[model samples]
Target chain A: MNRNRWLLLPLLLTLLFGFSLSLGSVRIPFGQILTILAGGDATEPVWADIVWNFRLTKALTCLLAGGGLALAGLQMQTLFRNALAGPDVLGLSAGASLAVALIFMGQAAGIRLLYEPSPWTTALVASGGCFAVVVIMLAIAQRLRDNVSLLLVGMMISAAVSSFVGILQFVSKAEEMQIYIVWTFGSLGSLNWPEIAVLTATLAAGTFLAIRSAKALNAWLLGQHYAQSLGVPIKRSRMIIILSTCILTGGVTAFCGPIGFVGLAVPHLVKLLIRTSDHKILIPASMAGGAALMLFCDVLAQLPGSTQVLPINAVTALIGAPVVIWVILRHPRMLP
Target chain B: MSPDTPTIALQTHALSTGYNNPVLHLLENMSLTLHAGELVCLMGPNGVGKSTLMRTLAGLQRPLAGSVTLEGGPGMPPEHQVAVVLTEKIAGVNMTVYELVTFGRYPYLDWNMRLREEDKKIIGQAISQTRIHGFTHKKLYELSDGQLQLVMIARALAQDTAVILLDEPTAHLDLNNRVEIMKLLQRLARETGKAILVATHELDLALQTADILWVAGKDKTLLTGLPEDLVLQGTLDEIFQLKGYDLKTGQIYHTAFRNKTVALHGEGYLYRWTRNALERNGYNIAASTPTDVTLTIEPGDRPAWQLRRGTATNLYYSLGELLKALPK
Candidate 1:
């Protein structure tokens, strides 16, 4: 079952990715997409720009953000032994959004910048917010003995950060508010080359760490005590899991503006389809599942043959929520 | 014929264990020994730190003061040397029985996590030892409590430890499964030559099955002895506060005596059972002192009970009819 589905995931990811590249308001032909991807001139010269500059970058962004967030969610669910735990559960995304909001609001309202800010500066500042939350969470994690309480504390932190973001939203000008609001809506087409490369590096590092801890993660399913008995160094493995999750979610939230649903929904969806809790199998499967789901949602977000594009966050929650609910209801063990 | 000298597998030297944060001491300065190839049951009242003691012995928690040693080394034993089965249930997991049993080899596995042919053989032996081969492919969520307990035991066996500590492995199991697991533990101890320590509340089962009994009471001490010796010395009774039940005669607790005393006369198995029936119905079976009523059991292919009340006498073929004829 795993072998067949393992092949199915990458296949789905590839198909959805290229299929999404061919879709848009102009609706480029599949042959033109192949020709443009193969470094040849398309029948229509404008097709290459739309494909390479807009659709191609957007598709790759979806893959990285989706796959990275999905793995983070999987790690959180296993670390906390919770069905609902995700990247957002720990408030890393919330933290990033809060920092981004503050940076946006401060620039226009008398908190002048010391230097010229690049597009990459936003990603870095957003990560500073994530690092702050991760530090505070790691400190609390040390004092707390169990995962259930840790999840509750994470939720509370998210709530507090959200309220802070709410305050920033309230006392802002129309233009500043629109910038923050559009960032919150989660865009995938905003990235240039350097941003994508940085996102790729973070995703690769996070994935590597996740794979290294796969053995410990499998033991974690038996729970902490049992995992300890099985010779899993509890503290070190715990630190690694949290760090990996933070890096993965932090990178995505910084670059993609807190895209919702893929992190929370993809692992459960993968587990439902793949039928194994072994992290050795689960991590890669979640990676593929997440990337495929994101590209599919991105295609829908494009709203083909229409000029207007829907928010990636809206398309994700609207599509991912019902599908997750259906999967959880049909196969109840998916949550656990 | 020579008598074999048993080797001690695990021992505690004046060990004191409790939580460190609050400076709470549960068991203080307690020394205990567990011999190899023995099934020892640690029986205690609730809140008397049986679990705390178990955790300390298994090295799950640190001892407050003194040390617990395995093979004369004072520290936590090697994971392969001391296997522990906690009371925590593995719930809603998609792991197969075989996969979990093989997980017992976790201590030996490196980052690769690939099991060798030898590890597979050990896992197979564990499954066969606990008789969980039938469900080797089944998911954990599909197993019953009895099956899951057996799987847990198999995992411990696969650990191939010198000592195995289980905290109430038979809890929430049916009577048949309880007996089956206890008997299996006894067999495993003898076969594997591992010291098995079970901390449980099943007094009756422990008394019947354990090679030695470790009874802990409110005084923070473990009184260890043979099962019969513990019962005879009144340690079990003292520890449990056996008020209504008689541990010596195996009598069930009954509230009503009703002041009705009968001199029951019989021999062997028939005599004990007749007394049980009479005693169960609020009738005191006197040993020697005679009352106006006397009941004698006539043992044969079809036994009969002869009941006498002063000059009036009645004979019933069965104890049931004789019980029915008694005055309410």
Candidate 2:
């Protein structure tokens, strides 16, 4: 019965994304938006720019970031076997946040950096920082056999990084603080074409690696000893999964700010829906489900007839928290 | 003996087993050959490394020193020759019985592999053989512990290896389930001609069921022989000390008696039934009698009796038949 429902997913996603582009304080007609998207002649250049440059990119950014975060989140959940495990839980997002904070604070202090940086350059640096933090966490996880202990260590690292960001925020000037605050709020609107290109490339690579590790992950679901018995190189598989999660999450955080909940919720949703732990189906299902969710949430963030736009995190929290609470109430045993 | 005697199904050539750097050996300088069509039971007390030895044999954990070799003859690779059912529960609860059983195909599958018709048929057969056919669609978490155990055994069966190793497969089961699982293992060994090795603490059941007893003693030496042979050699008494003496029949009990005064007159099949029932209900049954009852009425007669000034109800027949008249 639900198989037919799956067939409707792509159609629903296209409709949701198309409808989301027309939303905002200044409403653009759907036909004109389509015309502008097609790059044909248009009546208003301003409206064309607004639809083509702003909403389209923002919507696409949400789709990609949502999918990427969800995939990473699902991977982390499986690896740790903890429902609460997410890419953000490992402090990767905090790493990006801290790096961005440093850049803003340094600029505010009137220090002339060696490199002339663009927004994309800042994103790249942030992604590098996130990668470093993930590497550290992976190293620690490898040494610790206990999953809860590994989670606590990751939480401690996240806390430490957040404190450092706090210190940076304290020393920064008002204008710099404003820039940092806006970045922290997390907006899909800020990703330009260059950042989108980078995001797409990183997501593609991470997804490919995840797919390759699918069989190993299935073996891992039986525990490390069983996986080893099945001829899986546990350490090597762990490394690949960690690397993929870091790259995918780091890229999203850099370009679109640290979007939350999508990763944590999307995998669970896929598991709940498909009713199987097999990653062969799960990985692709999570990607599609995550993309649709992000697009939906982004559209909700820009409520029609309102001048004010909601923070992406706030929108995700609004949607994700209820589902999480419901999941907890229904199947409390699944929680670690 | 010839050097090549159709190579034993599983052999530990001077194998020493332990965990974490091999500081303390569980079984040292141990060498044994288990051939196909044998049911071997590893009997020992707790912490005797029966589980560890099983793990070593299953290739889940490495021995501290020495090696385990699986001789190829039963249509399987040497590496894939052993299948294991450990005491630990399989991790995933969301998986169906069918899916869990199909995982036994792991060693046979290549990258990007799908289940073949042959694999499906084997899995289906295993499910049926384990008597878990009705629960195929049920999630593992929904099944009873005994049912889950059968599923695990079915998974091992699906692996289709020559050597099947079970580490305390009956550890948590009730007596009935324990005997059922043991019988299943025995039947599998006989029917499929596979070597089945089980490590268990149920000495009486193991003695009755196993073809060969692999006794792991406190001295860390493994002795393998027929069950009756081991029993006759005082191995069972040496490992599990006999405690009580019977002065009348020269019979011994592994446990000491607390209350030995109660006895009644009984004889024949009815007497046997009464004895078994009384024993099960925590009353001792002895051959000699301390009290006698007179049967003076017909089958429908209910007479009165006296025991220490208290009157009790009685039945009419031979003492054995009267005892059988009591409610079960």
Per-residue lDDT of model 1, residues B1-328, tens digit only: 1348688889888999888999988778888999899999998989888888887887777889998888646454368778888887553367788888887998888776899998999999999999888889998878898999999999988988889999999999999999999999999999988999999998889989999998888577778899999898887888898878899977777655678888888998999888778878888778779688888889999899998989999999988899888876
Q: Give one digit per residue, the lDDT tens place, for model 1 in A14-82.
A: 899988887778878898899999999999999999988888898999899889989998999888877
Those runs of model 2 whose alpha carbons end farther than 4 Å from true positions after fitting are: A106-117, A141-149, A170-177, B1-7, B21-27, B73-79, B220-223, B234-273, B276-328
Q: What lDDT score goes with residue B168 in model 1?
A: 96
Which residue pairs in model 2 clash with each other?
none
State fnat for each of the candidate structures: 0.47, 0.31
Could you tell me every candidate's TM-score relative to the true structure?
0.94, 0.84
Q: In candidate 2, how many Å is residue A188 off?
A: 1.1
For model 1, what is the alpha-carbon lDDT of residue A80?
Answer: 86
Q: Candidate 1: lDDT over CA atoms?
A: 0.85
Cα lDDT, model 1, residue A207? 92
- Model 1's CAPRI class is medium
Give candidate 1's error at residue B187 in angstroms. Answer: 1.1
